[model samples]
Target: MVASLLILAVSGGMLWAVGLNYDGLTGGQAQKVHPASYLCVLLVLWQMLRRGNPVANLVSAAEHRPASCLLAAASIAMAAQIILRGASGTAGAIDTFLQAALVMILLLESDARSLRRLETLVHAVMAANAVLGIVEFATGQRFFPFRLDGATFETDTRSAALQGHPLGNATLTACYVLALIAGGGSLKPLTRLVMIAVQLVALVTFGGRSAIVVTLVLGGAFGLAQLLRAIARGRIPLLAAAGAACALPLVATTVAGLAYGGFFDALLGRFASDGGSANARVAMFDLFSRLPLRDLILGPDPSLVDSLRRITGLEWGIENPIIRVVLYQGALMALLLTTAVTLFLVEVGRRCRAGIAMPMIAFVVLINTFESLGGKTTLLAKFVIVLVALYRPFPETRIARAS
Candidate 1:
């Protein structure tokens, strides 16, 4: 319990740390290590020493061996690229290594002995973020003064919560919501419904178009799955089905009205205007297209942001994780990374009783499509822990005893 709480604190703090600019600690770079990283490092060291045989413990987890090998291979590939490219590539390479290291450390140190404990820790983190988001949205003021910008900190319409960007907040909320849905069977029906409702409200308040769309799709899919399950069991009453069919049109009308209403109009107004966001992504792609074949096979120029700016005359970073990985670390490495993650997700989905893994996977993919969440080391660490927990074999004896 103590270890779980500490892990939760470090993870939750890092999410909130995104919005902060620690001048002395980070030197104004948002990517640099902050207080949370220091705490996490200390916890990892303590846990490693306490265990006495870190290597044996790591090796004992046979299920994680493949993931470990894949991570190592990806690291080597990135390191080789950096060495070939020299000084300019060093920073990016170091960033990637640091992110990977943090994730590995968190996964190794986590004391969650079962999937239930792991889910509880994750849910606690999500709940913290959800509460902060709700407060930020209602009050139009952040609970913490962690701004990416060094100057002029002010909160207005958007609910940034602990994440620096509103879009990031929304994306994180969407991910948590999907996770909850996937693990809903672990909780009572009322508890699950309440948690889902709270998260949905928080996601809507954060107002990211990607979040909104992904949440809607996943929620609809979950509903359909439930309906199908009931039908399969002959549990759904004919009268209930008939009532649902008759009310479908009214529900559709209400949703349409809400979409055109003031709140949703304000929430999604940005996408309706000039296609700036879409165009920027296209511009990034265009810039990548002009790179030399050698660069494409090995890696692009070290100064990816600068190269994009030079080509497109716009100062924007890559938004898509797939494109970002390919541009930074060759296509082969990107494929390896994607395959590793996809396989793990599939494995978890196969093990899940509620069939929530597919929706969670979709949520991750959709969120990454519009945001570079894969680049965030802290969040990535949390994801690694979640994957590890899901991969762990269930304690059959404990389940039988409980039953």
Candidate 2:
């Protein structure tokens, strides 16, 4: 289990070591494929072969149908980009999606105990990273300096967690919070409460406005639903209540210790004005108006896209995968992307309780509004790991509901 989790963490891009710098693999950190990505490919190939070779394994198993369909659909976009626009057409975004898909496939084969262990590993990593985030914010010292190209550019605006992207860290931290609170990882009552506080605080340090807003709204909805369900049942369990009460003081103590150490100055400042993120989003859509209709409908040459970026004075390329698919892969590929994502949702959701699953999906979609998971991200990979770790089969849940 330890070895498996180590592979999983490294492959998922969750490590904190300096060696994981991911240099040379690709110059741009956001578009690079780390050494860990190669590890994922090897592990996936091994898993497929063990299941009776790649082709037969994917096609023959009834349980594999969902993953098979999703992969097939998603591959269309990636394959289309390569076939039509050449190997240089895409940045590393689609590669991230493919790596995440492979992670999901490997996880589906894990037994229940291994899944639980995986969740524990994720929780440990989250907690460690949260503490590191807090320290970085408190001391105004980041372990990993921000790199602009090959040069080290330092910043105090936000804590750069292990993965070295504040926004991505914020997104994953938010997802981790939702997953834990919604029910997944094994946690003692007090530990759970404390981690929630730590993670939420770390979230502020990372200062992702979208993650903060979406998490708050969805979290409130989930809380209300849980309360309503408990009330309708006519009673809260005495043991559960007693345990929560017992854990309250510890949770309070934990909060009191951490609360004053790091302030939300950065978060508050960004909330006032999003550093032109809103303007940038608006400008992205304007690219369509400027593009030739033919290029817009049928993926433009990547070089043409860049020339247009200069023409339009936009600062970045695609931030959202939904938009990226249409602009980079064309309209037909967009349909395939949507179909693939929908299939992935269904597959992941069935392994979790409906209450938890719905909110988690909502969180992913909301976070994606600001950035693409199909880009250089392990959010999808980690999210799927959490889902399976907390796995409660759909039929089992239905049986319980009926009873």
Best by TM-score, which number? 2
Backbone clash count, each prediction separately: 3, 0
Candidate 1, pairs of clashing residues: 19-146, 19-147, 20-146
Query: Ten residues in a row with the worst lDDT in model 2?
Result: 7-16
Give the alpha-carbon lDDT of every model.
0.57, 0.64
- lDDT of model number 2: 0.64
Scored by Cα lDDT, where does model 1 land? 0.57
TM-score per candidate? 0.73, 0.81
Model 1 lDDT tens row, 302-398: 5764666666854435667777777776677678667755554454344334445644665576657563533543344444444445344334344
Candidate 1 vs. truth: CA RMSD?
5.5
Give the winner by lDDT: 2
